[model samples]
Target: MNHRNPILFEVEKTLYPTVYTLWVYPDLLPAFSTWPPVLQKLAGGADLMLPGVAVPPSGLPGVERGALCAVTLLGNRAPVAVGVATMSTEEMLAAGMKGKGFAVLHTYLDHLWEYGDKSYPPTLAPLVPDPAGKESAGHEEEQEGKEPVTSSSPDPVKHVAISDLSLKETDSCAELMGKEELHESRAAEPAEDASPEEQQEAEDTRTPQEQMDALFNQCFFHALKCKVKKSELPLLTSTFLRSHMFSCCPAGQQLDIKKSSYKKFSKFLQCMQQQKILQVKELNKGVESIVEVDWKHPDIKAFAVPEGFSSASAAQDSKSEDREQVYHAPEIIPLYGVSTKMVPLFQESGHRKGSVLSSSEVRNIIINYVKANELVDETNKNFVKVNPILCDCLLDKSEQDEISHLKWDELLSRCLERLQPLHQVTFFGQEPVVRKGNIEPIDITLAQRSSNKKVTIIKNLELYGLDPQCVANILQQKVQASATISPTPGAKDRVQVQIQGNQIHHLAKMLLEEYQLPRKYIQGLEKAPKLGRKK
Candidate 1:
């Protein structure tokens, strides 16, 4: 017997060593610039540590967890090593710049680099300002009056530029302190205290472009930290601008990016990318997408939204969400209402003329009233003696028998019959609504019409405060059937919905699930055909 097999890309073989001819395209992954000694350690198969990595002043490049990244010497843009990030850029900073930073897989001196053409990293210009140079210059000034430190023993933290990690936060704190001091100084000066008009004039002194730029930056950072999420990433730039950033602007203040100094959306994105707020890439030709975001940036964390800004947008979102869900009427139950004639008997039980009670409740109240008044006959336990309230409520004038007593069943029946009909509709999360009228059960009937065709007819929906036309539209959409609404025959100002075929299954789901109507209130459910049975 002969067997046939096939192989995919030859690149898979060298993947374990992280070396291939594919490395020719150096910009394949996000590059993190660090010192040469750190690259040497990685070459020896040691994992990169956060303390050893040199972060530029602009900040670390935005990278997600486990994403492929390149490592380069601080002065050179050429990557000499390849690895996957152990965590996102924000997480690395959150760790206080301590712990493993990258899982190094390939380096210049590793076996993989030897397998390919053995070439050394080229001497290239640094893409960012060297933090070590600035630190050394500052350290010299601090030690001027103190002991003179020799250049032979330099601080390792200063050499590796680890101080850059805290630079952004320190600068932000200084800026805030500066603002506070300025306010205090103004308050201390008697002539500097200004009126509202003066403050307005001072604000108006700023150019329009400067004001627009400040507003643009505020909304951008606000949207990134508050409104946007990692899960919603790879979002289109246009959507981020309009749906998120624009909506976050103050209600009366419009956000026109064109008015800003950057003048173009692409320019703004490029500036943010340089600051490491986010990573924007062109997924498709000429279309930019935000692939990753740095949620823990110091600027984003420090930005506080102005009070009441975007309040209208937030409220509108909640209202729109509520509107999306259909409001289902409550389950309605019939009960007896206390008419003017029946008020006297129920009044002693704390029921007024408009009070409504169920049959059992009314029976219990009447029994209690009889027991409290000692109206039960002494001779027969089954008969209740008539009181003036009972005579006025239960006995009619046409019956002049002047009946002094009545049987227990007769008395209860007369009370219930004489009481006015009422219905109480109870909705979830709301109070029950009681109205004085009869509520007909929603009637659903399945019958054969022309040519033995089946039709489902629904009636009495309006009696429960439901519109037949609305119900018909919902049922038609749900069942994918033809539905028509017409005036109910022999009924005044009432309508009925008629749907093609026996749609009882869909109607049951709509009524029980969507409308939340009780099963007892919907009539003719048994008429629906049983499931999984042939006709």
Candidate 2:
């Protein structure tokens, strides 16, 4: 048996150089000059101090020298021949640490500072030497074997003062660290105001058209539901029926219908049709329901005709009988209650020639009579002539008293005399020649002048041409005067029916009440009746 195996190999590679950040306070700038030449160049320029520091000559009032300046390196790596210190250039030179001497001390400080107080020499004093003084060989050797000076001392007074100074420096460093950290954190946080994404989401939540469509669909569903529940027949017909039903429902009930949700009435009708609950023939039936029959059909009579008498011929006979009975005896009273009579006035001539008064003619006569009465009062002169026979029949006892007070004879004579010339005068037609002792040639041309007779008459009287207004005036007078009338029986059993002023007023009142209309609405009703059967 042959076996095949896969081969694998391990590989290693060098990593890229990492960058580091360094912080330098104003007091620590002089210490950086002590770094090795290569490291000093890597530190960049002197103007670049740490973020929380002010430059030397402008140092913050309470800041001290030899304070710790932050330096961030890659992982645990430290720069060669460099150390962290906080001191100005003037302070470093005064302490006799400059040039080559400062560079050596800086390297030693880096090594010893890492071990903190443990790396300090056992025997040392906290004091600087004068740069001008020369060192003795024996003293220099003795100092070399002793430990370096530290901020703390064994003496109680010196130790207490040094401890207090250390605490004050620590607090100042902490404050500066806190301010830098706070500034960085604030820069990284997001703005407090709303973002574009949030605004867009709010707008996308519900578009205007979507909201409108939802509202419309809800209303449609509610209307369909109401139609389905109340209808007895299939849904197809229910939609039409619902509209009529909704109108009948009170306004409050309509709101309730809107809130209801149910399947569309049309859907219900489709279901019913599928189930054969209603046939196509039934759907095609006319507006009336199946239980009700057409009343206009000849076979249907008397609302509930006998079952056996449902023939068309029998229904026709029933209808004829019904029509005949409609003419009852009370409606057929003889005109003037006369059976028959002979007229003596027409006996001498083949026919009577006196003009018979038409209804309109009678109305005109009554209107003229009222006008004449009004003019008589205003002008203080008699203007109307009343026939004694007709006056006696028309006036009641009280009306006679009112007429007597009106100076009946003089008023009648004046009115008749003034009207005599007008009665004989024909307008735009034949003019009657008045036989007089000496009269100018009859002015036929003048009499036939081209002018609207009605307009001319109205203008002459200074009155409106509207007939209704005139009629209203006459009616109002009759109401106030309370005129009445009576008629005598004649040989023809026909009495002269003179309508009194009060009777005219009663007719006007009836017209107003019965039709809820003014007299102007029936302007043509007061006319002559033809000699024939009533329409």
Candidate 3:
């Protein structure tokens, strides 16, 4: 344990014959030694507020929400308590250091400490006499210029009505849970025919807001102006409206949603959608949520920060400054000189027979065509009955006569065959691109499958721009075998063509002799001489 790192420590132990060291992390909330009474409260499992934390010369460590961090009381660097961060580092900084900080989980005096025979932290700094907790509370109240309301429980959390200066999201969460029940009860009561006292009582209960209508408008605009980000859409309806917008109502005025004319949350959302400000998209079959936002809306434009606030010249000059980290996408090597073939249904549909299409585009066309023609099986869509167009497109004449039913994936393989060989290009890396027209060394490997069945895999043939469907067809004819596409482990972007039988001998011959790829590019050919016979 040292200045920077205090809580983390390692211990060596032996079980039977073997000895090993293990690292242990305990719950200890870091605090300034300046505040011992606060540490005492924390030892009793009290949650920490931002105000109680003393900012040392070194700022708070970068901690994400839900990550466990040690709380080291000032002077002694050893952690006294452990807690989980309530908000992310960026959020805490953006919030100007106000509100709750860590939600304390465990401390030294807790039961967990009883199991360990550990020494207490060494105190080096002079211990100051503890100040009265009430006096500090009074000082805080005076600073905020608001009287503190006491709860019956000793818990630090205080619950106040909407009439309070600030209404937090945590406060409204419980109210929203019981909104429906309250609405139903209100309808059951004969409130309209009530006497003067009852009417006055009702009026008293409903805290009067002179700008109630205007407040809703203000909150709606405010939520959009600040809380809602352009990137967050399509937002979830329940999450966006009820959780976000409802909480944005000005402090001291609760958003009385029942008073609004809209009967339900969805009705209000529908009205927004109808106005074309944003579209509501149902995800996974009618699970409604805010799915889109109208970035170009006039109201949104008005609320948006004006462009060029930081002039282009200033931005250019400050390029070397330590700005926030941004993520840049990994560059992809572009492929050119590719073409695709048309399926039988679209053979004369004007798509060139040997033209090229991306793998995804080809898939979309096939699936959409199947759906539009209603060719999918009524019982199981995966099982497609042999049709003339499919027979011409997917299966060879030999296969057509022998097979009456085929799986959907097999058809996809045939579709992939129509694409012209793709030639890859390098943008900024040292990696060489095998000539777009030339075949690369065939990557061959042996692996065990379920039931201990061993299989041989061959890949890199596709990198030569050769149609995988054509290779599979040739393999089936020459070696009397079948193959399937297997996603390569550790390389998510690449897939290897897998053959059921160990066709290493044939696959190597096909690549070396038939494809005429340079011998230098070929790998594992020395092992290819062994007869890959079935066990």
Best by lDDT: 1
Residue lDDT tens for model 2, 1-535 = 0011000001111110101111101122222221111222222212112211212222222324543222221111122222224444456445433211111112212222222221221211111122222234223322331222123344322222212322233323223332333224223212123243442242234444433332333233223222222212222232222332222232222323223232343443343234333322233222211122223221111112111222422323343223222221111111111011111212222222232322334335444555644533445544443344224534455666556433545443333222212112111111222222221110101012235221000010001111122222333354443221112222121111122221332443434453233333333233322335221
On lDDT, who's better, 1 or 3? 1
lDDT of 1 by residue, 210-240 (tens): 6687678768866775566574567657557
Clashes of 3: 27
* Model 3 quality (TM-score): 0.21
How many clashes (backbone N, Cα, C below 3 Å) per candidate?
Answer: 0, 11, 27
Q: For model 3, how does the per-residue alpha-carbon lDDT over 36-99 read when each residue is reduced to its tens digit?
A: 3455445444555554554543456677886655665443454555556778767866865555
lDDT of 2 at 446: 9
Q: List the residue pairs that clash in candidate 1.
A: none
User: Candidate 3 regions off by >4 Å?
Assistant: 1-350, 429-439, 442-522, 525-535
lDDT of each: 0.61, 0.26, 0.46
Q: Over the full model, what C-alpha lDDT does candidate 3 score relative to the true structure?
A: 0.46
| Superposed model 2: Cα runs more than 4 Å off | 1-359, 365-382, 385-387, 398-402, 405-535
